[model samples]
Target: MSFELRRATVEDLSFARELTSQNMLRYYIEFELPWQDHAFDVAWSERQNWLIVRDSVPVGYVSLSRDMRALYIRELQVAEAFHRQGAGSWAIDQVIDIARGERRPAIRLTVFENNPARSLYERKGLQVQGRDECFLRMQLDISTPVL
Candidate 1:
């Protein structure tokens, strides 16, 4: 499937908020994350949000941030209809490409400890870095070429 990433703007905030709300129940249950309206606002405003477009339609969105140390993935929500079609992987590959271009040492993200996506991330070479009560911190060192 052909897809592209577009930077999300203020116009896309409402759609993003709704989509995230609809799909975040699993994480909420697993991690006790609050589904507060302000939380979405914070993410929409602070992170580099990207709308995953396929054939001119928005299929999903991912929120990413980069600090001096690593590329931090804050959110990745693929519409249910588009799941299992590689949208998530494509989005992640985009982030990896950015990290490589910047020569960043690693990519980091927090996944709900029991979230199924953790296994997919592990398969993609991210290792468990640490964990707290609700989240598992995972890291992928990108300084070395991925084999």
Candidate 2:
């Protein structure tokens, strides 16, 4: 699906919340207790945020926080139906591009332990930086993904 991403507005919150949580569940391949609010709160407290769209309809979401030299990506999620459709990659590309434009040091994000995207991140050169009960923080070198 063709789509575009703009800076998220307050109106995007409702949509972002759902997409973010649902994506977490899907990424982990679990839900029962994994989708709990506790999971989101951890990311939210970091001050990162996002909302993505496809063909004029919201299709994905994320949350990000920037510190001294790092772009902390809290969450990134595309609707289950949108998997392999480029929605998630599109959103991630935008974030990296924007960060590069700003000369950010590195990009960071926390993904569920079982998330398949970890492989994508590995190919993209994002290395494990830390971990929590629900997330494995990955860091990408801003100088170049190949570094």
Candidate 3:
């Protein structure tokens, strides 16, 4: 299936919210409806950091927000059927492309220590920059990876 990423518009909000809810329920065991409302509010309030699309049947969702000086990836989820494909990788690459387009310093995110996506992030150039007992503070520096 072919896919493309574009800025979210008002017309796409409902679809975005639907995709968000579906993915959240399937992948995020800690999901909450109120949080989804808050996220929708934040994402729609400022369209700078959210992208949602369905190449065919709504493959995934991702939300990135700027925090302090660093860009924080607030959420990313690929639909159950779309997992293990390149949907996520392309979405994340788009995030990096956005960062590059804006000339940002880095992208930072927190992930559950046991989550499988950590491996994907690591392979895609994200690293554990800091951490606590439960979560890892990962950062993707917008520079060439070390060889």
Candidate 4:
């Protein structure tokens, strides 16, 4: 049940991409959005990413970016086999700590409207701040104590 976060490397690209596709393709289809593989590459290049490893195997990853106002979670995908075992929640807690350490005012992310992960985000204190046809923008203000 112990998990560790390791900085993702170039070699992790394929694994991250495939894990994301597996978890998200259904939503893409449901929303009628095109699956653009290059988008992952673009984000991977621009953002900071980490692999969630259990023992020695990678079970998921989280990608992040930062602005003066907040730390943004660009992507967080957990392999199906590891879901409900706390990998996702642990990642979020790590992100919260990162934001706190960086003195960011908040943490932000966009989740597909029906994605089950939304509940996990909500449980972690991120509230829905806005929404579009396909996504809900959520945020957790960490300027004050949140631990």
Candidates ranked by lDDT = 4, 1, 2, 3
The list of candidate 4 runs beyond 4 A from truth reads: 144-147
* Clash count, candidate 4: 0
Query: lDDT per residue, candidate 2, 1-147, as tens digits?
Result: 577866676566667667665655555455245456665555465565656777777778767788777887777778888888877777778888878877788998877778798887777778998988777889987874543
Taking all chains together, each candidate's TM-score versus the true structure is 0.91, 0.77, 0.72, 0.96
- Measured by TM-score, the strongest candidate is 4
**Which tens-of-lDDT digit does each residue in 7-98 have in candidate 3?**
55666667666766675554355532244566676665574534545654556667777854667777776767778888788888888887
RMSD of 1: 2.4
- CA lDDT for candidate 1: 0.87
The alpha-carbon deviation from the true structure for residue 95 of candidate 4, after best TM-score superposition, in angstroms, is 0.2
The prediction achieving the highest lDDT against the true structure is 4
Model 3 alpha-carbon drift over 4 Å, by segment? 10-49, 52-56, 144-147
lDDT of 4: 0.96
lDDT of each: 0.87, 0.73, 0.71, 0.96
- Candidate 2 differs from the real structure by a C-alpha RMSD in angstroms, to one decimal, of 4.0
Q: lDDT tens digits, residues 25-83, model 1?
A: 76786666678888779867988999999999999998988998999888888888998
Question: Which one wins by TM-score: 1 or 2?
Answer: 1
Sliding window of 10 residues with minimal summed lDDT for model 3: 26-35
Instruction: Report, for all candidates in order, the number of backbone clashes.
Output: 0, 5, 0, 0
Poorest stretch of ten by lDDT in candidate 1: 25-34
